[model samples]
Target: MKPRTSMVILFLLPASLFYLALFLVPAAWAFYYSAFDWSGFSDTMTFVGAGNFIRLLTEDPVFWRSFGNTLKIIFVGGFFTFSLAFLLAVLLNSGIKGKKVFRALIFMPNVIATIALTTLWAFAIYSPRSGILPNFFKLIGWEAGTKFLWMSPEHVFWSMLIAIVWINVGYFVVLILAGMDGIPLEFYEAAQLGRLSIHYGVWKTPAHLPVGLRHCHWRDDAPADCCSQYRCAPPDEARIPAILGENP
Candidate 1:
């Protein structure tokens, strides 16, 4: 083999092995365990073949609700996240002052741990009695907002969706902003010189503009007061069985 080919294999070898061990092995184990009925505390796992899957699909109302919530996170959460991120990216890219400061402020949440961020939302922001929202509403004499129960069953799903969006929007803004910055200044100059419209110039940039125009597609969900990916979060009465136990 060529020396360059050998060097490429040496670089990729560790990552390939890491993926196989951490992701592939665990996923396979989860699939194997899904065929059984186990409360997760017992020594013996009962072999029920497709019984568990059948119950989840046809008989479980909680499963259906969590499934619906997942869909909401994919669609609704994605919409808000991308829209806000794109807007912020555009504003920042337009020669805004203190761009670095604004970028750091927006991305600060991502610098902190996810679990810590969730705790802040649950206790500091969403707590009805003494939380920020309630206190602000009370100060403004908005009685309904003061009395709102954000963590309550009826509102918890939407509340979580909002939190998830806030946590992820910053990272996407950075992504899209980098792409926008790659676009040549000549395009904008052409627009300013009346050789092209601003819209035409931005839209017509061949390579880099497509990266900026691409929509955010985030699949991971945050864990705040409940599991996002597992569909075990509340608003559904009962918990879904932990058969597979948090698969990626």
Candidate 2:
């Protein structure tokens, strides 16, 4: 084998071992446990032979409800979170004044502990009787003090989605903005050149042209510009410091 290939293998060996130990081992153990009738804390163990899986499939209403709720949250909440984050990232990246301050303020929720944020959402924001949202609703002439937000099955999923989105959108915005920042200005210029006139004194550009062109360019130069232009580091050195702050 080549010496360079040997060195690459040597470097990756530790990470491969770590993944096996931390992830694969636990996954295998879980598979084994799933086949048994172990109460998770007892000594006696019985082989269930897929009996537990059959029971869950036929008998578990709450399990099915939870699964449905999870799918609803992923599709509905994910759409809202992704759309909002993308819009915010585009606006933030548009050379807006005080963009850094806005980004920091948006990202501030990420610094707060998850449990603390959940507690605040549950008690202070959604308490229904005297909470901030209830008070706001009362001011709008609606009877908001009648229901406990988290206790009601109908509203609990939405409340959870709101909390999750509030906590997560910031992190996703940062990621999407980082990706946007990496896109070269040359592509945007090329895209602008491809603009078409739609009506009188009005020009319209195909929004997807730049992304499509970028992929085509990368495919043509797979060995060279593939990992450089589309995947190059930004010229700005302050990006990391701006995102993480100077305390680190």
Candidate 3:
């Protein structure tokens, strides 16, 4: 039997109110404030209906550049991150030995403080003199590669994109893996009985079902993904299976 409308509303009401209180209301206030010109510290607000937006669009090269970077992170970085996560999640789920240990190792970067990761990337990985990449290039007799400055303006954005992808891929991998784990083992057994490759079934079947599509359901989680590149998981998020409970 279908749930009654009242029952549906009763279950959703608490979350709906929370969303309005925390997100929608604040967003509405921001949209309202966008119509005015006010130094956030000033007592006076000057009404400049759409003028601020006009200035942002026409008079701001820096704003446009930053906006472009945001788009790049969303599209370019997201593609690499999710693609790698899907491939790794599939491989990791293929009855690999020590899978739990591998998962923990992959997830280590996410749990670490972001500043520490940045420092490691800047000094140990990208540094021109003694960094890993430079030295590897040197060892390979690639002088031009050894001298390349990864932090330079020409390369910094891509470097940051790579770091963002590296830090966040593990979390998504774990998420996809969890979804795969939810699939009935009998499904795989049935596939095997039909002389079908289990790996193909795992990848192909889930892609059409809720398991694969779950990651695409909420793009608003972008804040969590983007900020995670620079911050440790929040306290509640650090609770292992508790965080996983949302997806489950």
Candidate 4:
């Protein structure tokens, strides 16, 4: 081989092997199991020949609901997540006092353990009778969405979505805040002094999703693919499977 070709091969070989082992091989195994009649670690493996796909399409209602819920998560969830993240980023970047403390407060939720988070939300906030949400609404006398059974079968999907959005907001807040930090302070200063719309330029962050989601989903890489389709996930990354309430 030419020296240039040899050098290229040397550089590409490790990445190629890694892709084959981690990505390609696992994908091939998934495909193999898709056609099987095996019950997860059973000794016997029967070839079912497209039975899984057929059953999912024809017989499964929950799968379709989960699929629809996934779609809701992608579009609705993504829209709200990005909007809230940008809104907070803009507010924080607007020369606010004690911004460091505010930033830490926003990002702290993403650092907490997912089990603790779910428990807190379930027991403290969504406890139906004496939850913080109901008490807060009662204090304000709004009485909207506070009376519903948040963890019920009917409301669980939206409850899960809201919880996911709330926890994941901090991750995107940190991400978009980092993106905003790159903007020249002069723009924000001018906006403060002369009152301009330069802040909009800082919020244009469609390109940041891949990097943000990849870093956020590093350990929990499975949702990286699924959520990348929707365009977001929490920073802790462990809450997704549990949030979806899926089982083996």
Best lDDT goes to which candidate? 3
lDDT of 4 by residue, 185-238 (tens): 544433332221123222223442224322223333333243444444465545
Q: Compute the lDDT of residue 237 as modeled in candidate 2.
A: 33
Better of 2 and 4 by lDDT: 4
**Scored by Cα lDDT, where does model 1 land?**
0.74
Q: Estimate each model's TM-score.
A: 0.72, 0.68, 0.65, 0.63
Residues 22-70, model 2: lDDT tens digits? 9999999998999999999999989998988988889999889889989
Candidate 1, TM-score vs. the true structure?
Answer: 0.72
- Compare the candidates by TM-score and give the number of the best one: 1
Model 4 Cα shift for residue 241 (angstroms) = 52
- TM-score quality measure for candidate 2: 0.68
How much is 221 displaced in model 3, in angstroms?
A: 47
lDDT on C-alpha atoms for all candidate structures? 0.74, 0.71, 0.76, 0.73
**lDDT, candidate 2, residue 93?**
90
Question: Can you write out model 1's per-residue Cα lDDT over 15-109, one digit (the tens) per residue?
Answer: 99999999999999999999999988899999999999999999999999989999999999999999999999989988999998998888888
**Model 4 worst lDDT run, 10 consecutive residues:** 193-202
Compute the lDDT for candidate 3: 0.76
The local lDDT score (0 to 100) that residue 20 gets in candidate 4 is: 99
Model 3 earns a TM-score of 0.65
